[model samples]
Target: MKPIVRVVRTGTANLASVVASLRRVDAEPVLCADPALLRAADRVVLPGVGALGAAMGTLQGDLGDALRARVEAGRPTLAICLGLQLLLEGSDESPGVPALGLVPGRARRFDGDALRVPQLGWNRVEPDAGCRLLEPGYAYFAHSFYLPDAPEGWAVARTTHGVTYTSALERGPVLACQFHPELSGAWGLGLLARWLEA
Candidate 1:
């Protein structure tokens, strides 16, 4: 039977794209914001594409607590873009806004005027030797803030924009990506398939 993947509804933009991507991979996708569904998930996909403050606001109280518990137990979980950002301690985008803090780090804005903000295009990512799902290639990116410092050993891939930032993180059953695998065409679907298999 196909693995059940619950897409946690964090009220982020491009959520539908993620669902479609999962379906392409042949994994079952359940669009859910309910805490009970989150708690019972065998595999969970936390996808987001909007402001950090608003995202955190929607995942308040028991829903937030349940997610924490699930991650702490090392259940298979995937975080994408803003969902990945929310796993950190906090973000510079919205100062003073607390985050889930699953991965020890902070999301910082791009510095210098050398590159445009939001990075609205495809960019290459250098995966760590341990990252088997994808080889080094371009992935879709659309964000202004990035996690530059995420404790040692957490980052499984790195990409350069204005600076070398974490492109993906892997620690146990938890996986996160700064880029949108859903919008990244074939390679993206392949990556999602690998996660589902895990």
Candidate 2:
């Protein structure tokens, strides 16, 4: 199946990271920001990073409408990092920013003094046993905040970073991850290839 990979297009740095990740998965990523661009593909993949408030603001004001329509249509979709944060109603990290509310719960940092902000490097994200999004290995994560928990029927996979946090989610054909699959090396690329197969 063809996946219409989309980069949020907020900054060059974010776009570069996305480009690198998609190429690793061997998927066709489109540069267009318009919702109509999604019409050409069978699935959607959204990759993002940076501030959640700013990201949600753009999605709400612009891409939000388009994405909502696309995902609701049942075309498979996925999100990574800030892309995952944009899935909720809003984040406690940055108050007042409206989110997609696709999943329940708000986002927050490590919430502990011992743990570092922006937990970097490789981490193991275990699947819920019932979750279909994971294999047996872990995914890469680089972020300060995380989804505490997605409402029932939403959470598909999870990982520990300072604390156990939601790592992946699925609602219908929509699949999202709190980790950066592209940066996870073999595991990440393999995950993308699998998503395409699914």
Candidate 3:
């Protein structure tokens, strides 16, 4: 039987592409926002787009708590783009708002003085030695805020735009990506396939 992947309804995510990508990998993608279902899922994909505050607002209360508990328990989860940022403590984009805090640190804006903000388009992701799903390839990135460094004990993947930042971080069954894998072509699909198999 195909693995049932619960795609969280963040109210601000690119659900169409994400759902299509999961289906392409032969997994059953269920779009859900229920806290109970989220905690009980075999696999979960937390996808987000647009502003951080708005996404956080949608995730407040039981939904946010459920996601934190799921990741803390080391369940299989794939967080994409703003989803990755939501895993951190907070972001510069929205001050005084607490995030899931699954990973330490905050998301900061790319230095506009040094290079372009948002870092739109494809960029290289250099995976660390122990990465299971991420490979060295150009992934599609569309964000202004980024985690400056990798948290300890997480399998890190780095990418450079203005500065070298953690493009992806994996620990146990939880994987987070700063880029949108659903829109990232073959390399992204391969990563999704590996995650599904794992």
- Number of the top TM-score candidate: 3
Residue 185 lDDT (model 1): 93
Q: Kindly list the per-residue Cα lDDT of model 2 for residues 1-198, writing each as its tens digit.
A: 544566555442266666777776777786666656654456666777778776665565546776777666766777778787787778877887778876678888787878877788888877776666576576677888888764687647778766777878876567788888878888888887777767
Candidate 1 local lDDT, 60-176, one digit each (tens): 887788789887887888989998888889999888889988778899999887889988889998888776555688899999999885467563789899789888887666789
- After superposition, the stretches of candidate 3 with alpha carbons farther than 4 Å from their true spots are none
Q: Whose TM-score is higher: candidate 2's or candidate 3's?
A: 3
Runs off by more than 4 Å, candidate 2? 1-4
lDDT per prediction? 0.85, 0.72, 0.92
lDDT of 3: 0.92
The C-alpha RMSD in Å for every predicted model, in order, reads 1.4, 2.2, 1.0
lDDT comparing candidate 1 with the true structure:
0.85
By lDDT: ranked, best first = 3, 1, 2
By TM-score, how accurate is candidate 3?
A: 0.97
Evaluated with lDDT, which candidate comes out highest?
Answer: 3
What tens-digit string does per-residue lDDT give for candidate 3 at 1-198? Answer: 988999999888779999999999899999999999999999999998999999999999999999999888999999999999999999999998888888998999887676987689999999999998788999999999999988987999999887899999998789999998899999999999999877
